[model samples]
Target: MPWGERPRWARWVSVIWIVGFVEGTGAHLLDLISGGLHAYHAWPLPSQVLFHALLVVDLLVAVLVARGLPSGPPLGAAVMVTDLTANYQGNWSGLLHEPLAYVGVTGLLPMTLFGLFVVGTALPLGRAFRGIVRPV
Candidate 1:
């Protein structure tokens, strides 16, 4: 089948999936190149470690979502929710940094928008599957 022949929800989900993957991967790379998570400022070592660990998970979710496999939507939705929550935390913590503060500030809106899109597409896919199994 041609790529666009899939359900509309699936198409939108795939779009958001790619967006998230690119954004997450970009953030991690920026963090690395800037000299580790807290290298710009100073956070406790444990918190910094946990922060980077979460970013890794974020990147993995992006990969899963971008794969666009038929079975991945619901799981990707869950991951997107978690990822948004983490982004929220990052936004709040970002208050501590002056020069880099825009990272958190600018991300808030896109993250919220994509988070909604992920959740929106995930639920319908689940319901559609349920209908398929029931065979009305």
Candidate 2:
């Protein structure tokens, strides 16, 4: 099938990814714009830059994935994992000293799981949606 023609489920997944990318990017941008560098003073300069850069890269990958690029999802997943790690470190309040602090941050876990799901299924999902495999 042509790149424009993809299965409905695949399209839905792509839309979900795009929405996540927008939300994630928007949140970061809002913080930077509204609160400025002081908002991220909790993290080091390099860490802040790295996290934002990764977000931009993830957004680009999301666009490619939405356009049916076969490699996009796995790459996005890797980016998401790295982003998650950065978030964890930035928010770290002594995991060993206060294990409950980790649980206080709920968003990271679900997002990580979703990213893993995308990575695990990317190839088969891409093939299935492109009509390379029959729908089961």
Candidate 3:
């Protein structure tokens, strides 16, 4: 079937994945410059490594987004979960305890966006496949 003839939910899922990857990549670049990543104080070295690793992961997500294939949802799901953990840890590292901590906490915005993307992509994608496999 042609692209347009595909399920509308699938198209929306693709759009969400595309947005997630784009936002993820942009957030990483901003962190590199604005020192926004300092929110991750515990195990600073590993945190930095994970921070950079996400850039690679985001690139992979971008490819999946461009392809708009069924695989995008699962990959985006993984990214969303990872982002949640990372953000939670970063926020709780006592980095946000100081007076000016709000500046660093801004990293959560991308995380929030990631959650939205995951929900947008997964909910509709799940609906698209709801009846695919019948009971044996």
Candidate 4:
């Protein structure tokens, strides 16, 4: 579809995923830089691996979605869901004791929000991405 031809819903959904991946890329990068390989030291071995893997996966999916590939949204969805699960597993008990911890900006809040966004818009974002013109 032409830029002006795509529906509003598609355009909005596209913005949502694009912004998410772009920010995710930055967050993972910074985590790696500041914490080296031990940023997720609080997490289990598997979660730590997944967290590290996102440093590359987030950028890859961001590029793919920027290029308008239809495959990006599903991959993004998978990343968020898995990350959320791992984060909850790692932090649930601690956060439960301090209810206000859930509101922390760098804590589970952003991940939870983004995961919710991906869950809500995954299908529509996939459709939107397919119609997006691939970035040069």
Question: lDDT score, residue 26, model 4?
Answer: 85
- Per residue, candidate 1 scores C-alpha lDDT tens digits across 1-136 of 1235555655565666767756766776788778864653454455466457656666665555555444456766776676666556655655456535454545666667777877876766444433332222
Q: What is the lDDT of residue 123 in candidate 4?
A: 73
lDDT of each: 0.60, 0.69, 0.63, 0.78
> What order do you get sorting by lDDT, best first?
4, 2, 3, 1
lDDT string for model 3 (20-121, tens) is 678777777776667765633454576677776777788787676555455556777777787677766766755557635544444565567657768555
Against the hidden true structure, what lDDT does model 1 obtain?
0.60
Off by over 4 Å in 1: 1-5, 37-50, 89-105, 125-136
Against the true structure, whose TM-score is highest?
Answer: 4
What range of 10 consecutive residues in model 1 has the weakest lDDT sum? 127-136
Tens digits of per-residue lDDT, candidate 4, 1-136, equal 3435556766676667778877877888898899999988888999999988988888877776666677877988898899899989988898889978589776689879888988777777677656644332
What lDDT is reached at residue 77 by model 2?
A: 74
TM-score of each: 0.59, 0.71, 0.64, 0.84
RMSD in order of candidates: 5.3, 3.3, 5.3, 4.7
lDDT of 3 at 47: 64
